[model samples]
Target: MKWSRAVHHVEELARRCDTPSPVPMLPVTGLWVFGDLLGEPRDLDWAHVAVIVDLPVDDVPWLDIPRGGQHWAQAVRLREPLSCLWRSAAGPVWNHRIVRPALVWDSTDGVRESTLSALRDGLGHSVRLDAPTPSALQTQLDAELAVSLRSLRRQHRSYDDQRWRPGKLTPHADSLWRATDGYLDLLDAVNAPQ
Candidate 1:
Protein backbone atom coordinates (compact mmCIF):
# COMPACT_ATOMS: atom_id res chain seq x y z
CA MET A 1 0.00 0.00 0.00
CA LYS A 2 1.16 3.53 -0.67
CA TRP A 3 1.45 6.18 2.08
CA SER A 4 -1.74 7.81 0.92
CA ARG A 5 -3.69 4.56 1.31
CA ALA A 6 -2.15 3.97 4.72
CA VAL A 7 -3.28 7.43 5.89
CA HIS A 8 -6.74 6.86 4.51
CA HIS A 9 -7.17 3.53 6.29
CA VAL A 10 -5.93 4.91 9.58
CA GLU A 11 -8.18 7.93 9.34
CA GLU A 12 -11.18 5.73 8.64
CA LEU A 13 -10.24 3.48 11.53
CA ALA A 14 -10.10 6.45 13.90
CA ARG A 15 -13.54 7.69 12.89
CA ARG A 16 -15.04 4.22 13.11
CA CYS A 17 -13.60 3.76 16.57
CA ASP A 18 -15.63 6.84 17.61
CA THR A 19 -12.45 8.84 17.88
CA PRO A 20 -12.00 12.28 16.42
CA SER A 21 -11.29 12.51 12.73
CA PRO A 22 -7.62 12.74 11.88
CA VAL A 23 -6.11 16.08 10.94
CA PRO A 24 -3.17 15.88 8.62
CA MET A 25 -0.10 17.51 10.14
CA LEU A 26 1.25 17.98 6.63
CA PRO A 27 -0.13 17.18 3.23
CA VAL A 28 2.32 14.28 2.77
CA THR A 29 3.84 13.99 6.23
CA GLY A 30 1.34 12.23 8.54
CA LEU A 31 -1.96 12.53 10.37
CA TRP A 32 -2.90 13.00 14.02
CA VAL A 33 -6.01 13.22 16.18
CA PHE A 34 -7.16 13.85 19.75
CA GLY A 35 -6.19 10.27 20.56
CA ASP A 36 -2.61 11.08 19.68
CA LEU A 37 -2.20 13.36 22.67
CA LEU A 38 0.37 12.12 25.15
CA GLY A 39 -1.77 12.14 28.25
CA GLU A 40 -4.08 9.37 29.49
CA PRO A 41 -4.98 6.69 27.01
CA ARG A 42 -8.69 6.76 27.80
CA ASP A 43 -9.07 10.52 27.73
CA LEU A 44 -12.02 11.55 25.55
CA ASP A 45 -12.57 7.82 25.31
CA TRP A 46 -9.77 8.00 22.79
CA ALA A 47 -6.93 5.59 22.08
CA HIS A 48 -3.76 7.28 20.92
CA VAL A 49 -3.75 6.52 17.21
CA ALA A 50 -0.57 7.24 15.34
CA VAL A 51 -0.52 6.99 11.53
CA ILE A 52 3.19 7.07 10.82
CA VAL A 53 4.30 8.00 7.32
CA ASP A 54 5.93 5.42 5.04
CA LEU A 55 8.31 7.28 2.80
CA PRO A 56 11.20 6.16 0.65
CA VAL A 57 13.95 4.57 2.76
CA ASP A 58 16.32 7.53 2.41
CA ASP A 59 13.57 10.10 2.94
CA VAL A 60 12.34 8.86 6.31
CA PRO A 61 12.78 11.35 9.14
CA TRP A 62 15.29 10.63 11.86
CA LEU A 63 12.81 11.56 14.56
CA ASP A 64 9.47 9.77 14.48
CA ILE A 65 6.92 11.01 17.01
CA PRO A 66 5.02 7.73 17.28
CA ARG A 67 8.10 5.64 18.05
CA GLY A 68 9.73 8.05 20.49
CA GLY A 69 8.49 7.48 24.01
CA GLN A 70 10.08 5.08 26.46
CA HIS A 71 6.83 3.13 26.99
CA TRP A 72 5.84 3.33 23.33
CA ALA A 73 5.26 -0.40 22.78
CA GLN A 74 3.20 -0.61 25.95
CA ALA A 75 1.25 2.43 24.83
CA VAL A 76 0.50 0.73 21.52
CA ARG A 77 -0.83 -2.39 23.21
CA LEU A 78 -2.78 -0.49 25.82
CA ARG A 79 -4.28 1.93 23.33
CA GLU A 80 -5.92 -0.99 21.43
CA PRO A 81 -6.28 0.74 18.06
CA LEU A 82 -4.87 -0.73 14.89
CA SER A 83 -1.23 0.37 14.51
CA CYS A 84 0.70 0.75 11.27
CA LEU A 85 4.05 -0.24 12.72
CA TRP A 86 6.87 1.26 10.64
CA ARG A 87 10.07 -0.73 10.76
CA SER A 88 13.60 0.72 10.42
CA ALA A 89 13.30 2.13 6.92
CA ALA A 90 9.81 3.65 7.15
CA GLY A 91 8.56 0.33 5.85
CA PRO A 92 5.01 -0.71 6.67
CA VAL A 93 5.57 -3.51 9.14
CA TRP A 94 2.15 -4.25 10.63
CA ASN A 95 -1.56 -3.49 10.50
CA HIS A 96 -1.01 -2.31 6.95
CA ARG A 97 -3.35 -5.10 5.98
CA ILE A 98 -6.26 -6.80 7.68
CA VAL A 99 -5.54 -10.34 6.47
CA ARG A 100 -5.26 -12.00 9.91
CA PRO A 101 -7.52 -11.90 12.93
CA ALA A 102 -4.75 -10.38 15.01
CA LEU A 103 -2.70 -7.96 12.95
CA VAL A 104 0.96 -8.87 13.11
CA TRP A 105 3.97 -7.50 11.25
CA ASP A 106 7.78 -7.68 10.82
CA SER A 107 7.58 -11.48 10.74
CA THR A 108 4.93 -14.13 10.85
CA ASP A 109 4.87 -16.21 14.04
CA GLY A 110 7.08 -13.68 15.76
CA VAL A 111 4.49 -12.25 18.14
CA ARG A 112 0.75 -12.18 18.70
CA GLU A 113 -0.81 -8.74 18.38
CA SER A 114 -4.32 -7.40 17.84
CA THR A 115 -6.94 -4.88 18.75
CA LEU A 116 -9.65 -5.33 21.36
CA SER A 117 -12.40 -5.57 18.74
CA ALA A 118 -12.71 -7.53 15.52
CA LEU A 119 -11.83 -6.18 12.10
CA ARG A 120 -15.53 -5.71 11.53
CA ASP A 121 -15.43 -3.18 14.34
CA GLY A 122 -13.60 -0.96 11.90
CA LEU A 123 -16.98 -0.44 10.26
CA GLY A 124 -15.87 -1.90 6.91
CA HIS A 125 -12.78 0.24 6.79
CA SER A 126 -9.70 -1.65 5.58
CA VAL A 127 -6.60 -1.30 3.41
CA ARG A 128 -3.10 -2.63 2.86
CA LEU A 129 0.29 -0.89 2.64
CA ASP A 130 2.59 -2.50 0.12
CA ALA A 131 5.76 -3.28 2.01
CA PRO A 132 9.31 -3.57 0.73
CA THR A 133 11.41 -6.72 0.80
CA PRO A 134 13.75 -7.21 3.75
CA SER A 135 16.90 -6.63 1.73
CA ALA A 136 15.47 -3.47 0.24
CA LEU A 137 14.50 -2.25 3.68
CA GLN A 138 18.00 -2.91 4.99
CA THR A 139 19.55 -0.98 2.14
CA GLN A 140 17.34 1.98 2.89
CA LEU A 141 18.28 1.91 6.55
CA ASP A 142 21.98 1.77 5.68
CA ALA A 143 21.72 4.72 3.32
CA GLU A 144 19.92 6.90 5.87
CA LEU A 145 22.37 5.99 8.61
CA ALA A 146 25.32 6.79 6.38
CA VAL A 147 23.90 10.19 5.47
CA SER A 148 23.15 10.94 9.11
CA LEU A 149 26.71 10.05 10.08
CA ARG A 150 28.14 12.40 7.48
CA SER A 151 25.85 15.21 8.56
CA LEU A 152 26.86 14.76 12.17
CA ARG A 153 30.52 14.86 11.16
CA ARG A 154 29.98 18.14 9.36
CA GLN A 155 28.26 19.59 12.41
CA HIS A 156 31.20 18.55 14.56
CA ARG A 157 33.63 20.23 12.21
CA SER A 158 31.62 23.47 12.17
CA TYR A 159 31.47 23.58 15.94
CA ASP A 160 35.19 22.85 16.33
CA ASP A 161 36.27 25.41 13.75
CA GLN A 162 33.98 28.15 15.02
CA ARG A 163 34.10 27.72 18.80
CA TRP A 164 37.65 28.93 19.30
CA ARG A 165 37.73 31.59 16.62
CA PRO A 166 39.30 35.01 17.25
CA GLY A 167 36.06 36.34 18.72
CA LYS A 168 34.09 35.44 21.85
CA LEU A 169 31.85 32.35 21.79
CA THR A 170 29.17 30.78 23.87
CA PRO A 171 30.08 27.82 26.10
CA HIS A 172 27.03 25.90 24.83
CA ALA A 173 28.86 25.00 21.63
CA ASP A 174 31.35 22.95 23.66
CA SER A 175 28.59 20.88 25.27
CA LEU A 176 26.75 20.63 21.97
CA TRP A 177 29.64 19.07 20.11
CA ARG A 178 30.41 16.79 23.06
CA ALA A 179 26.91 15.36 22.91
CA THR A 180 26.95 15.14 19.13
CA ASP A 181 30.27 13.31 19.19
CA GLY A 182 28.94 10.78 21.68
CA TYR A 183 25.85 10.12 19.62
CA LEU A 184 27.98 9.90 16.46
CA ASP A 185 30.12 7.24 18.13
CA LEU A 186 27.02 5.26 19.08
CA LEU A 187 25.77 5.44 15.50
CA ASP A 188 29.13 4.20 14.33
CA ALA A 189 28.72 1.13 16.46
CA VAL A 190 25.22 0.58 15.10
CA ASN A 191 26.43 1.02 11.52
CA ALA A 192 29.25 -1.46 12.04
CA PRO A 193 26.66 -4.15 12.97
CA GLN A 194 29.21 -6.36 14.73
Candidate 2:
Protein backbone atom coordinates (compact mmCIF):
# COMPACT_ATOMS: atom_id res chain seq x y z
CA MET A 1 0.00 0.00 0.00
CA LYS A 2 1.07 3.58 -0.55
CA TRP A 3 2.71 5.23 2.45
CA SER A 4 0.12 8.02 2.60
CA ARG A 5 -2.78 5.60 2.34
CA ALA A 6 -1.29 3.37 5.00
CA VAL A 7 -1.04 6.38 7.29
CA HIS A 8 -4.64 7.31 6.55
CA HIS A 9 -5.79 3.75 7.21
CA VAL A 10 -4.17 3.77 10.64
CA GLU A 11 -5.73 7.13 11.45
CA GLU A 12 -9.17 5.84 10.51
CA LEU A 13 -8.71 2.70 12.56
CA ALA A 14 -7.67 4.78 15.54
CA ARG A 15 -10.81 6.90 15.12
CA ARG A 16 -13.13 3.90 14.86
CA CYS A 17 -11.52 2.54 18.00
CA ASP A 18 -12.40 5.84 19.72
CA THR A 19 -8.75 6.68 20.02
CA PRO A 20 -7.07 9.98 19.16
CA SER A 21 -6.16 10.82 15.62
CA PRO A 22 -2.57 11.18 14.46
CA VAL A 23 -1.59 8.54 17.01
CA PRO A 24 1.24 9.34 19.36
CA MET A 25 4.56 7.76 18.39
CA LEU A 26 7.75 7.02 20.30
CA PRO A 27 9.24 10.45 21.05
CA VAL A 28 12.64 9.19 19.95
CA THR A 29 14.13 9.92 16.51
CA GLY A 30 12.73 7.18 14.27
CA LEU A 31 9.80 6.40 11.98
CA TRP A 32 7.47 4.03 13.81
CA VAL A 33 3.93 2.64 13.52
CA PHE A 34 1.86 -0.18 15.00
CA GLY A 35 2.04 -3.73 13.70
CA ASP A 36 -0.17 -4.66 10.75
CA LEU A 37 -1.82 -1.55 9.29
CA LEU A 38 -5.17 -3.32 9.36
CA GLY A 39 -7.02 -4.27 12.50
CA GLU A 40 -7.13 -7.82 13.97
CA PRO A 41 -8.34 -9.84 10.98
CA ARG A 42 -4.97 -9.75 9.25
CA ASP A 43 -6.46 -11.20 6.06
CA LEU A 44 -7.15 -7.72 4.76
CA ASP A 45 -4.79 -6.42 2.08
CA TRP A 46 -4.36 -3.07 3.76
CA ALA A 47 -3.08 -4.84 6.88
CA HIS A 48 0.25 -5.48 5.19
CA VAL A 49 1.75 -2.08 4.52
CA ALA A 50 5.27 -0.88 3.84
CA VAL A 51 6.18 2.71 4.55
CA ILE A 52 9.55 4.29 3.80
CA VAL A 53 10.11 7.56 5.58
CA ASP A 54 12.79 10.05 4.63
CA LEU A 55 14.15 11.26 7.92
CA PRO A 56 15.15 14.84 8.67
CA VAL A 57 18.47 13.83 10.18
CA ASP A 58 20.95 11.18 9.08
CA ASP A 59 22.55 10.65 12.47
CA VAL A 60 19.68 8.80 14.17
CA PRO A 61 20.31 5.17 15.25
CA TRP A 62 16.73 4.29 14.31
CA LEU A 63 18.04 4.27 10.77
CA ASP A 64 19.72 0.92 11.51
CA ILE A 65 16.48 -1.01 11.72
CA PRO A 66 15.80 -3.31 8.77
CA ARG A 67 12.50 -4.18 7.10
CA GLY A 68 10.77 -7.19 8.62
CA GLY A 69 13.60 -6.97 11.08
CA GLN A 70 13.14 -7.90 14.70
CA HIS A 71 11.24 -5.24 16.61
CA TRP A 72 10.06 -3.49 13.48
CA ALA A 73 6.29 -2.89 13.69
CA GLN A 74 4.97 -3.42 17.19
CA ALA A 75 1.52 -4.37 18.42
CA VAL A 76 -0.09 -1.46 20.23
CA ARG A 77 -2.25 -2.28 23.22
CA LEU A 78 -5.35 -0.31 24.20
CA ARG A 79 -3.82 1.49 27.20
CA GLU A 80 -0.31 1.63 25.80
CA PRO A 81 1.19 5.01 24.97
CA LEU A 82 2.00 5.58 21.31
CA SER A 83 5.65 6.01 22.08
CA CYS A 84 7.80 2.93 21.30
CA LEU A 85 10.33 3.70 24.03
CA TRP A 86 7.62 3.23 26.65
CA ARG A 87 7.26 -0.49 25.92
CA SER A 88 8.57 -3.35 28.00
CA ALA A 89 12.09 -4.47 27.14
CA ALA A 90 10.83 -8.00 26.37
CA GLY A 91 8.42 -6.56 23.81
CA PRO A 92 9.23 -6.15 20.12
CA VAL A 93 11.58 -3.45 18.87
CA TRP A 94 10.57 -2.11 15.40
CA ASN A 95 9.84 -3.78 12.06
CA HIS A 96 10.85 -1.03 9.66
CA ARG A 97 14.24 -0.84 7.91
CA ILE A 98 16.60 2.10 8.00
CA VAL A 99 16.79 3.68 4.58
CA ARG A 100 18.87 6.60 3.37
CA PRO A 101 16.32 8.51 1.38
CA ALA A 102 18.01 11.64 -0.05
CA LEU A 103 15.54 13.91 1.70
CA VAL A 104 17.20 16.23 4.21
CA TRP A 105 15.52 16.68 7.56
CA ASP A 106 15.78 19.75 9.74
CA SER A 107 17.34 18.76 13.08
CA THR A 108 14.26 20.11 14.83
CA ASP A 109 11.74 17.78 13.19
CA GLY A 110 11.09 14.09 13.79
CA VAL A 111 9.14 11.13 12.37
CA ARG A 112 5.90 12.63 13.65
CA GLU A 113 6.16 15.59 11.30
CA SER A 114 6.67 13.25 8.36
CA THR A 115 4.21 10.49 9.29
CA LEU A 116 1.28 12.34 10.79
CA SER A 117 -0.98 13.84 8.12
CA ALA A 118 -1.88 16.75 10.34
CA LEU A 119 1.78 17.71 10.76
CA ARG A 120 2.63 16.84 7.18
CA ASP A 121 -0.14 19.07 5.87
CA GLY A 122 0.77 21.89 8.21
CA LEU A 123 4.42 21.76 7.21
CA GLY A 124 5.73 24.42 4.82
CA HIS A 125 7.77 21.88 2.85
CA SER A 126 7.32 18.42 1.38
CA VAL A 127 8.91 15.08 2.35
CA ARG A 128 9.65 12.20 0.02
CA LEU A 129 8.49 8.90 1.44
CA ASP A 130 10.71 6.71 -0.68
CA ALA A 131 13.35 3.98 -0.51
CA PRO A 132 16.92 4.89 0.49
CA THR A 133 20.13 4.77 -1.50
CA PRO A 134 23.25 2.85 -0.51
CA SER A 135 25.28 6.03 -0.21
CA ALA A 136 22.68 7.75 1.94
CA LEU A 137 22.44 4.70 4.20
CA GLN A 138 26.19 4.57 4.67
CA THR A 139 26.36 8.27 5.41
CA GLN A 140 23.66 7.93 8.03
CA LEU A 141 25.44 4.99 9.66
CA ASP A 142 28.68 6.97 9.71
CA ALA A 143 26.97 9.92 11.35
CA GLU A 144 25.39 7.67 13.95
CA LEU A 145 28.73 6.09 14.73
CA ALA A 146 30.37 9.47 15.16
CA VAL A 147 27.66 10.61 17.56
CA SER A 148 27.96 7.43 19.60
CA LEU A 149 31.75 7.77 19.80
CA ARG A 150 31.45 11.37 20.88
CA SER A 151 28.95 10.44 23.58
CA LEU A 152 31.28 7.72 24.85
CA ARG A 153 34.13 10.20 24.95
CA ARG A 154 32.03 12.78 26.79
CA GLN A 155 31.04 10.24 29.38
CA HIS A 156 34.63 9.25 29.85
CA ARG A 157 35.69 12.87 30.29
CA SER A 158 32.96 13.70 32.79
CA TYR A 159 34.97 12.08 35.59
CA ASP A 160 36.31 14.41 38.29
CA ASP A 161 37.58 14.53 41.86
CA GLN A 162 34.01 14.31 43.08
CA ARG A 163 33.81 10.84 41.60
CA TRP A 164 36.82 9.74 43.61
CA ARG A 165 37.70 10.78 47.15
CA PRO A 166 41.23 10.94 48.58
CA GLY A 167 41.66 7.30 49.62
CA LYS A 168 38.80 5.45 47.98
CA LEU A 169 36.13 5.81 45.29
CA THR A 170 33.20 8.01 46.33
CA PRO A 171 29.61 6.81 45.95
CA HIS A 172 29.03 9.34 43.20
CA ALA A 173 32.24 8.26 41.53
CA ASP A 174 31.23 4.60 41.49
CA SER A 175 27.84 5.44 40.01
CA LEU A 176 29.48 7.57 37.35
CA TRP A 177 31.90 4.79 36.54
CA ARG A 178 29.10 2.27 36.12
CA ALA A 179 27.06 4.59 33.95
CA THR A 180 30.05 5.46 31.82
CA ASP A 181 30.89 1.79 31.35
CA GLY A 182 27.32 0.90 30.47
CA TYR A 183 27.11 3.67 27.89
CA LEU A 184 30.47 2.72 26.48
CA ASP A 185 29.28 -0.83 25.89
CA LEU A 186 26.17 0.37 24.14
CA LEU A 187 28.20 2.63 21.88
CA ASP A 188 30.55 -0.22 21.13
CA ALA A 189 27.60 -2.33 19.96
CA VAL A 190 26.52 0.46 17.65
CA ASN A 191 30.01 0.85 16.27
CA ALA A 192 30.37 -2.85 15.60
CA PRO A 193 30.10 -3.70 11.91
CA GLN A 194 26.86 -5.18 10.71
**Most accurate candidate by lDDT:** 1
Model 2 lDDT tens row, 1-194: 44445445544323332322123332222223433331222222332222332323222223222222222334323222222211111212221232211112121342333334532242312333444454554554455456445544544554564455465555445445544553454456445675
lDDT of each: 0.36, 0.34
The residue pairs found clashing in candidate 2 are 26-83, 56-105, 71-93, 71-94, 71-95, 72-94, 72-95, 73-95
Regions more than 4 Å wrong, model 1: 1-61, 64-128, 165-194
lDDT of 1 by residue, 9-46 (tens): 44454333232223232112232222222222222322
Clashes per candidate, residues 3 or more apart or on different chains: 2, 8
- TM-score, per-candidate, Cα-based: 0.32, 0.32
- Cα-based lDDT at residue 108, candidate 2: 36
Model 2 error, position 20 (Å)? 18
